[model samples]
Target: MESWELGEWYGEFLDALNRHDLEAVRSLIDPGVRRAHLPRGGEAWIADLGEFFHAFPDWRWKRIQLVIEDDRIAAHLRGSGTHSGHYRDIAPTRRHVNVAEFAIYRVTNGRIAEFSGSSDAELRAQLA
Candidate 1:
C-alpha cells in the first residue's frame, strides 16, 4: 500500500481504538500480528491490546503523529483512562492514569502484521 493509504489505515485503527470498538480493531489487524511487548514476553498483538482495553474501559488513544516509511508505520500515542479493571498482572486500583506511548507497526496488505510498543512506566506508577 502507498504511504498515504498506510496513514489512513492507521488513522482508522486509532479511531477504532479510541472508540473502544473491539470488532473494528480485530478487523484491522492481521491474525498473525505479533506484539513485542507483553507481560508474558510475547503474544498475539490483538490479545495484548484487548487486555489493555479490558483493564481500562474508558481508555482513550490519541494519535499524536503517524509516520510511514517503506512498510513500517510509527505512531506516537497519548492516552488516558481510569484503572478500573485488571491489566495483565496489575491489580485493579480504580485510579486515573495518563500514559504516552510510542509504537512501531509493520504493515502488510494494509493490515498491521507486527507491532512493538512502550509506554511511560513512570506515569503508570504515579497514577497507581
Candidate 2:
C-alpha cells in the first residue's frame, strides 16, 4: 500500500480501537498476526485489547507521528485514559492518565500481520 494509504489504514484502526469496537479492530487484523510482547495471533491480541478497554473505557490515542517503510509502519502515540476498572492486580483509582506509546506494525494484504511496541507498565505506574 502507498504511504498515505497506510496512514489512513492505521488511522481507521485507531479509530476502531478508540471506539472500543473489538470486532471492527479484529477485522483489520490478520488471524495469524504476530505480536512481540504478547501471545502470537489476532485472537490473543484482541483479548488483550478487550481487557484494556474494560480497564480504561474512555481510552483514546492521539497520533504523534508515523514513519512508513514499505510494509512496516511505526507509530508514536499519546494515549490517555481514565482508570475506572481493574487493571491486572491494581484496583481502579479513577485517575486520568496520559502515556506515550510507540509501536511498529507490519501490514500484509492490507491487514496488520505483525506488531510490537509499548507495554502497559507506564500507564500502570501512573495509576499506582
Candidate 3:
C-alpha cells in the first residue's frame, strides 16, 4: 500500500482504539490477529484490549511519529490514562500515567494482521 493509504488506515485504527470502540476494531483487525509476538489469534484479542479500558476509563493513544513501508507501519506513541481500577493485579492508585511505546503493525488488505509493542519501563516502576 502507499504511504498515505497506510497512514490513513493506521490513523483510523488508532482513532478507534482511543475511542475504545471495539466494533471498529473488530472491523479493522483480521479475525486471526496476532498479539505481543504470540501465536494467540482469532477474534478473542478484542477483549484483551478491553482490559485497558476496564482499568483506565479515560485511556487514550496518541501518535508521536509514524513510518510506513509497504504494508508495515511503525509508530512511536504516547499512552495516557488514570488508574481507576485494578490493572494486571495492581490496585488502583488513581494515578495518571503517560507512557511511551514504539509499535509495529502489519496490515493486509486494510485489516491489521499483527501487532507488537513495548511501553516505558518507568510506568511499571511507578505502579510498584
TM-score ranking from best candidate downward: 2, 3, 1
TM-score of 3: 0.91
In model 1, the Cα lDDT at residue 2 comes to 88
In terms of TM-score, the best-performing candidate is: 2
lDDT of 3 by residue, 1-128 (tens): 88998998888999999999999988998888887855566466777678768989998989999999988999999899998988877889999998887898899988888888884366677677
Residue-by-residue lDDT tens digits, candidate 2, 37-71: 67988899899899888989999999999999999
The candidate with the higher lDDT, 1 or 2, is: 2
**Of models 2 and 3, which has the larger lDDT?**
2
Clashing pairs in model 3, backbone N/Cα/C closer than 3 A: none
Cα RMSD (Å) per model?
A: 2.7, 0.8, 1.6
lDDT of 2 at 93: 95
What is the overall TM-score of model 1 with all chains considered together? 0.84
Most lDDT-accurate candidate? 2
Residues 1-128 of candidate 1: C-alpha lDDT, one tens digit per residue: 88998888888988888988777888887777776754321235556677888888898988888888989999888889988877766788888887788999898876777888895575568555
Q: Would you estimate the TM-scores of all the predictions?
A: 0.84, 0.96, 0.91
TM-score of 2: 0.96
Give me the runs in candidate 3 sitting further than 4 Å from their true place: 119-121
The weakest ten consecutive residues by lDDT in model 2 span 119-128
What local distance difference test score does each model get? Answer: 0.79, 0.93, 0.85
